[model samples]
Target: MEYKYNKNEKTAYQKGYRVTKEGIVIGKKKNPVGWLHTNGYRRFKIRDHEGKNRNVGVHRLQAYQKYGEKLYQEGYMVRHLDNDCTNNHYDNIDIGTASQNAHDVESERRKERAIHASSFIKKHNHEEVKAFHEKYGSYKKTMEHFNISSKGTLSYILNKES
Candidate 1:
C-alpha cells in the first residue's frame, strides 16, 4: 500500500532537539538519540530550546500531524515496515489494520528465517545438516541438534546444496 506524507511538514528545531514530521528525533547537534518507549515505540523527551520538557512518541506526533488526530480511531495501528519500532521515520510508518500488521510481522519473520538459513549454510555447509539428520533420525530433531528453526528453510538448503 502507498503511504502518504505531508510535504509541508517542517522539522522543528527545539532547544536541544530537532523533531521531524516523519517522526525522527535528533538531539544535540542533530545526532540520533531516540529511545524506545515502554510501549515499544521510539520516543523523545527533552527540554526544547524553549525550556519546556516535551515527552511524546515520535509516531504519534507525526501521525497526528500527517493523518490528523482522527487517525487514532479504533482497529487501526501504526506499523513499521521494517518491524523495528525504534525506526520511526515517517516513511516507515503506515496506518494498517491489526491483521495487516500481524501479516507484516510474519513476513518479516520469514525474511529473518531466510537470512539465518543462508548465513548458517555459508558458515557450516549442508553436510552439517546431513550429519545431524543422520545422527538424530528426523528433520525436527536435526533442527533441535543444530539450534535452528525453519525446517522448510533447512529442507531447501539440503536440497539445493546436496
Candidate 2:
C-alpha cells in the first residue's frame, strides 16, 4: 500500500532498494537482473513514504519528471506508443489528450463513425424526418440528391447558427 523511502535506505545496487512503512518492510529489494526479470508482473510496486504510487524505476521517474509539467498544462496523459504499459522509456512515451488517448485504442472505428454520422444527420433530418420527405421521396434518394455526411451533428450546427 505504501513504501517508505529515506536517505539511509539508499544502497550500493541502484535497484536493490526497498522502502518500508510503520517499521515494516513492504517488499524485498531487487537486483538489476531481478528488477528487469522479463516477467510480466513486477514483484513490487514502488510506493512513496505516504503510500501514493510513484513509479521510481530510474527510466520511469526520469520520464515523469521530464514531461510532468508539460503534460499537466495541456491536460494530456503521457502514453507509451509501444503499447507496452511498463516500458516508460522517454522515446516510447507521448503526450495525448483524453480523446486523443482513446483514439489510440480505437481510432479507425471512431473516424469511420464521425465521417458517416456527419452526413446521415444532414440528410435524414431534411428528408423523412420532416414534411420535406414527401417532396424529397426517400432518405437514400435525398442523400444521393444532396450528399450530406452524418445526421448526428446537425443539431450542433443549427444551434451555433441560431
Global lDDT of each candidate: 0.63, 0.42
Best-performing candidate as measured by TM-score: 1
Q: Each model's RMSD to truth, in Å?
A: 10.9, 13.7
lDDT string, candidate 2, 69-129, tens digits? 4534445555655555556455655777665555555556555565556555554454333
| lDDT string, candidate 1, 52-76, tens digits | 6666667655655567635556667
Counted clashes in each candidate structure: 3, 11
For every model shown, what is its TM-score relative to the native structure? Answer: 0.42, 0.34
Candidate 2: stretches off by over 4 Å = 1-30, 33-44, 51-62, 106-162
Q: Give the TM-score of candidate 2.
A: 0.34
The candidate maximizing lDDT is 1
lDDT of 2 at 87: 60
Candidate 1 ranges with C-alpha deviation above 4 Å: 1-18, 26-34, 38-40, 46-55, 108-162
